[model samples]
Target: MPNSPSAKKALRKSQKRRLVNRSNRSALRTNLKKARVAVEGQPSEAADDVKTAMRHLDISAGRGLIHKNKAARLKSRLAKKLNAALTES
Candidate 1:
């Protein structure tokens, strides 16, 4: 229970922000899953999947949902997988 007016307002804002953040996080996960599926189904599409994953990673990092270094590392791993698939093919 927020007794103060400002606290009530903050609570309301927090709820809204939570909803938005949840959607963004869900979207990020969805994109990652799509990329993984694409890579598994068609190795040739790994490059494109990596591109999409990297774009989503950048967006997540820019919005402060994920750390820049974490984003970079994820992108690096995805890129590496993509490159390996390409080389193997």
Candidate 2:
């Protein structure tokens, strides 16, 4: 329905971007889930997954895919869980 050339190009670009963002977001969610489950298991093993998830969060936030504050909060909570698990073990 885009009559203008610029609008058509913009729509194309947005569709491409949407696909990329969706893939990245899916990966991020998977990482976060793994990290969370790991945190509930063993401290030593969980640390690496938590670090990976945090890295993904930071990268996604920097790329403007997610809010910086949301990223920070998730990282903080994950770090806290990791620390608690570490202390308990």
Candidate 3:
């Protein structure tokens, strides 16, 4: 419980931010999953999926929702997988 008025307002703002961040993170995960699936199931569409996922990651990182290094690592891993799949096909 927040004792001061300012504290209460801060708590309220944090709750709202939490909800928004959760939604954004969920969408990011969904996009990553789609990219992974496309990599494994359809090489032709993998590039576009990867692009979408990377864009989302960049946006999330820019907004401070995710770390920039984390986003870069994820992008690297996904690109590696995509390349491997493409080469194998």
Report per-prediction Cα RMSD to one decimal.
Answer: 1.1, 0.7, 0.6
Candidate 1 segments exceeding 4 Å error: none
Clash-forming residue pairs, model 2: none
What are the lDDT scores of the predictions, listed in order? Answer: 0.85, 0.95, 0.97
Q: Mind giving the per-residue lDDT tens digits that candidate 3 earns over 1-89?
A: 99999999999999999999999999999999999999999987789999999999999999999999999999999999999999999
**Full ranking by TM-score:** 3, 2, 1
Worst 10 residues of 3 by lDDT: 40-49
Write the residue-wise lDDT of candidate 1 on 20-63 in tens digits.
98999899888888887777678796667668888999999999
Question: How many clashes does each candidate structure show, in the order listed?
Answer: 0, 0, 0
Which parts of model 3 are misplaced by more than 4 Å? none
lDDT of 1 at 20: 93
Query: What is the lDDT for 66 in model 1?
Result: 86
**Descending-lDDT candidate ranking:** 3, 2, 1
Which pairs clash in model 1? none
lDDT value, candidate 3, whole model: 0.97
The regions of model 2 sitting more than 4 angstroms off are none
Which has the higher lDDT value, candidate number 1 or candidate number 3?
3
Per-residue accuracy of model 2 over 1-89 as CA lDDT, tens digit each: 89999999999999999999999999999999999999997778887899899999999999999999999999999999999989898
